[model samples]
Structures are given as C-alpha cells and as structure tokens.
Target: MILETRGIGKRFGSVLALRDVSMGVRAGEVTCVLGDNGAGKSTLIKILAGVHQHDAGTLLVDGREVRLTGPRDALDRGIATVYQDLAMIPLMSVWRNFFLGSEPRKGLAFDVARARRVAREELKAMGIDIRDVDQPVGTLSGGERQSVAIARAVHFGARVLILDEPTSALGVKQAGVVLRYIARARDRGLGVVFITHNPHHAYPVGDRFLLLNRGAGMGEYGKADITPQELTSLMSGGAELEELAHELRRE
Candidate 1:
C-alpha cells in the first residue's frame, strides 16, 4: 500500500468531522471517496495532504508510521494533492506556472527555455494536447488545467495523488478529459485518492469505493462488491429514495 490511515478522526471544538476513518490506497489503483456535502470528505483529504493535524489517528506511508506536519511534509514524502482550485496562476504562462517556486536553475538563473520545453514534453508524454506551453494558464480550459496539474504532480514524483473534487465543475466532455488523465495517473502506478460527489464519474475508474455521510463512514466497498447503481443509491440515501418513490406513486 502507498498510504493508510488508521482510526483517523478530526474534531472542530465540540463537533466531530470524522471518526475512526480508516482507508488505504495502493499503487496502481484508485480509491474513490464518495460523500454528500459536509460528509467529512474534505477533512480526510486535508489530513492526508497535511493541511490539518488529525485530532486522532495513525498515518502510515509504505506501512511505516509517519507524522505529516503540513503540506510540505506530505510533498516531501512523495504525496501530492491537486485541489479543486487547480492552483495555477491565471496570468502566468503554462510553463511558468509548471515550474513556479521550483524552477530549474542554470548558473543562478531560472532556465525559462528549459522549463517551457520540459513542460511541453511532459504534457505530450502524458497524452495531453496543448497548443503552446507559453499560453497563459487562464486561457486553458478547465479540463486542460486539471490535466496540467495532474501532470505536474506525476512529474514531481508523487507516489500518491489526492484529488479534491476534480470534476465537480466540469461539463460531461471536460470531465471525460480529466477522467482520462486520472486513469493515466493510475496506469503509471501511482495510488490515487479521488474525492467527489459524482457517482457516475467515480464508478467508471474507481477500484474501491468509500462512502461517507454527515461526517461518518458508511462503508468501503471493492468494485466487485458493489454496483454503480448500489453505490449511487447509498450515496443518495437508500431509504430516503425508497420513501420518495413510494410517496410519488399514483394509485
């Protein structure tokens, strides 16, 4: 396994956001975290990304206990998270954004040309099509930006990629594009944690499913253990759906 959390819990003063949440991600597989709003999904990802200190839990990387103090700590351990915001500077060119804060240095100068070439090559290698690496990041479509972010994470040696709502704002076609990059990331042998509310999006690529409701885990299921319809029903409230169906029936 690439990453694991045992009995992870987070609290905000008196309220518990998560309780005893244990999940694992393995190389070459995608673990989809499906939850409704306020279901502790964000809290879990934040803990994994080191954005928040867990109130209680054991975090393991490669089966060894480790303390993730902050985002840098996570990155140092080869765990990278691409948030919903995409994190690309809008006015900056793609290549510039790609090398932001970690630019290639050639004799005390940023290697601008090298960065552009490398950014272009890396995207191409990942099967991402970009008209030019010098285009401002804002000019790229949402899916393209997400793909660029994913490519950046992989190029930087991310062993585990935690994505937060990657396809939430995307249209069907754009979502499809991002989904392809996700599969590509998994194919390259990186363990992936995909957090989303979209069942259709998760069902196709996920190898394992984790469902959360109101800051608690319902359960985790393998792909073979649950169908997409079943997963959706669970997410939408199985009993609630049945009640609504019964209420809507006309005699």
Candidate 2:
C-alpha cells in the first residue's frame, strides 16, 4: 500500500468529524472516496494532505506510522493534493501556473523557455492535450485546467494524488476527459485518491471504494466485491432514499 489509514478519526472542538475510517490506496490504482455533502470527505482529505492531524488511530505511509506537520510535510513525503479550487491563477499562462512556486532558476533568473518546454512535455506524457502552453489558464475548459494540475503533481514526483472533486462542475464530456487523465495517472504507477460524491464518476476508474456517511464509514469495498449499482445505492443511502421517494409521492 502507498498510503493507509487504520481506524483513523478526527475531531474538531466537541464534535467528532471522522471515526474509525480505515482505507488505503495502492500504487497504480485509484481509490475512490465517495460521499454526499458533509460526509466527512473534506476532513479525511485534510488529514491526508497534512492540513490537519488525525486525533486518533494511525496514519501509515508505506507501512510506517507518522504525523505530518503541515501541507509541506505531506508534499515532501510524496503526497500531493489538488483541491477543487485548483489554486491556479487565471491570468497566468498554463506553463507559468504549472511551475508556479518551483520555477527553474538560471543564474538567479527564471528560466521561461525551459519552464514552458517542461510543462508541455509533462502534460503530453500524461496524454493531456492542451492546445498551447502559453494560453491563459482561464481560457481553457475546466477539465483541461484539472489536467494541468494533475500533470503538475505527477511531474513533481507525487506518489499519491489526492484530488478533491475534479469533475463536480464539469459537463458529461468534460468529466469523461478528466477521468481519462486519472486513468492515465494510475497506469503510470501513481496511487490516486479520487474524492467525489458521484458514484457514476467513481465506478468507472476506481479499483476500490470508500464510503463515508455523516462522519463515519459506511464501508470500503474492492471493485470485484461490489457492483456499480451497489456502490451508488450504498453511497446514496439506499433505505433512506426509498423512504424519501415514498414521502414525496403524489397522493
């Protein structure tokens, strides 16, 4: 396993945000974290990204227990998180945004040519087809922007990629575009942590599924252990959904 959480729990003030959640992601596989709003998905991502520490249980990286001090700590450990906000400057060029902080230095000056070349090469390696490296990021479609972020993480040596709702705002075609890049990353031997509420999105590329409901775990299942219907039903609260349908039925 590349990353594993054993019975992990997180608490904020008196309210416990997560409890007894055990899940792991292996190299060259995608582990989908599926939940609706307020399902503690963000809490779990925060812990994994080193934005917050787990209050209980253990977090293991490559079988060794450790505590991350902050986001930098996680990155140094080869755990990279690309939040939904994307954190990309819209006005910046694609290549500029790709090498935002860690720009290559040539005698105390930024290497613009090298940055553009490397960014284009990295994006191509991941099979992401961005039209131009010099185009403004905001001009690209949402899925293309996400592709840049994913490619950036992979190029920078991310052993584990934690994506926060990459496809939530995209249309059907765009979502498929992003999903294709995700599979590409997995194929390249990177363990991907794909967090999304859509079972439709999760079912296709996921090797394993982690279901969270109201700050607790529903369960985790390998793809072979559960069908797509079961995954959608379980994450959407099968019994509750039925009850809701009946409650809203015409008289």
Candidate 3:
C-alpha cells in the first residue's frame, strides 16, 4: 500500500466528525471513498491531505506512521491533493496553470518555452486531447480541466493523489471523460484516493471501495467482494431510499 489509514478519527470541538475509519490506497489502483454529504468524507480526506490533523489512530505512508504538519508536508512526501476547487486561475493559459507557483526559472526569468513544451508533452502522455496548451483554462470543458490537473499532479511526481469530489459537478459525458483520465493516472502507478458519493461513477474504475455513513465506516471491500448495486445500498439512508421509492411508485 502506498497510503493507508488505520482506525482514523477526527473531532471538531463538540462534534466527532469521524471515527474508526480505515482505508488504504495501493500503487496502480484506485480506492474509491463513497459517502453522502456530511458523511465525514471531507474530514477524512482533509486529515489524509494534511489540511487537518487526526485526533486519534494512525496515518501510514509507505508502511511508516506519520503525523503530517500541513499540506506542504504532505506534498514533500509525494502525497498531492487536488481539492474540488482545483486552485487554478480560470483566465490563465493551460500551460501557465500547469506550472503555476512552481514555475521553472531560467536566469531569473520564467522558462515560458520549457513550461509550454512540458505541459503539452505531459498532457499528450496522459492521452488528454486538449487542442492547445496556450488556450485559457476557463474555455476548456470541465472534464478537460480535471484532466489537466491530474496530469500536473502526476508530472510533479505524486506517489499518491487524493482527489476530492472530482466528478460531482459534471454531467454524464464529462464525468466519464474525467474517469478515463483517472484510470490513466492509476495505470501510471499512482495510488488514487477518489472521493465521491456516486457508486455508479466509482464501481467502474475502483479496485477497492470504502463506504462512509455519518462519519463512520459503513464498510470497506475489495471490488470482488462487493457489487455496484450492493454499494449503492450501503450509503447513508440507503434502506430508507427503497421505502421512499415504494411510496412514489404508480399502481
């Protein structure tokens, strides 16, 4: 396993947001973290990404226990997180966004040529078909933007990529496009922690699934051990969903 959490728990003053949650992401595999709103999905990923510290249990990277100081600490250890907001300037060119903040320097000047070339090459390598790296990022489709972010993280040598709700705002076609790039990243040997509430989106590419409900572990299973239908049935209020469906059915 490249990243693993054992009995991880977190608290926010009077609220215990997460408890006894354990999950792991292996190299070249996708670990899908599924949950509804307020399921502690955010809290768990925040802990993993070093946005928040865990109050209990252990976080392990490469088989060693760690207490991450912050997001910078996680990044230095090859753990890169791409939050839902993506941290990109919409008006900036794709290449500029790719090398933002970490731009290469050539004698006190930004290496514009090197940045553009590397961005194009890396996107091509990831099988992303962006028309031009010089185009503004805001003009690209949502899926295209997500792909570029994934490619950037991979290019920067991320051993483990934690993506938070990457597909939530996308339509079916666009969501599928993002899922393809996610699989491409997994193929390149990055342990991907894909956080989402949709079982339909996750079942296709996930090697392992961790279901969260009300800040606790619903269950964790390898793909072979669980079916997509079963997964959807395990979410918070899953059983209640069936009852609601019955009431709405036409006779």
Q: Local distance difference test, per candidate?
A: 0.93, 0.96, 0.93
lDDT of 1: 0.93
- Candidate 3: where is the Cα deviation over 4 Å? 240-251
Worst 10 residues of 1 by lDDT: 242-251
The TM-score that candidate 2 achieves is 0.96
- In lDDT terms, which candidate is top? 2
**Tens digit of per-residue lDDT, candidate 2, span 1-251:** 98999999999999999999999999999999999999999999999999999999999999999999999999999999999989999999999999999999899999999999999999999998888999999999999999999999999999999999999999999999999999999999999999999999999999999999998988899999999999888976897988888989953
Per-residue lDDT tens digits for candidate 3, residues 1-251, read 98989999999999999999999889999999999999999999889888999999999989999999999999998999998889999999999999999999899999999999999999999999999999999999988999999999999999999999999999999999999999999999999999999899999999999989889997789999998788877864768888888888953
lDDT at residue 130 of model 3 (Cα atoms):
92
Whose TM-score is higher: candidate 1's or candidate 3's? 1
| RMSD each, Å | 2.1, 2.2, 2.8
Error of 1 at 2 (Å): 0.7
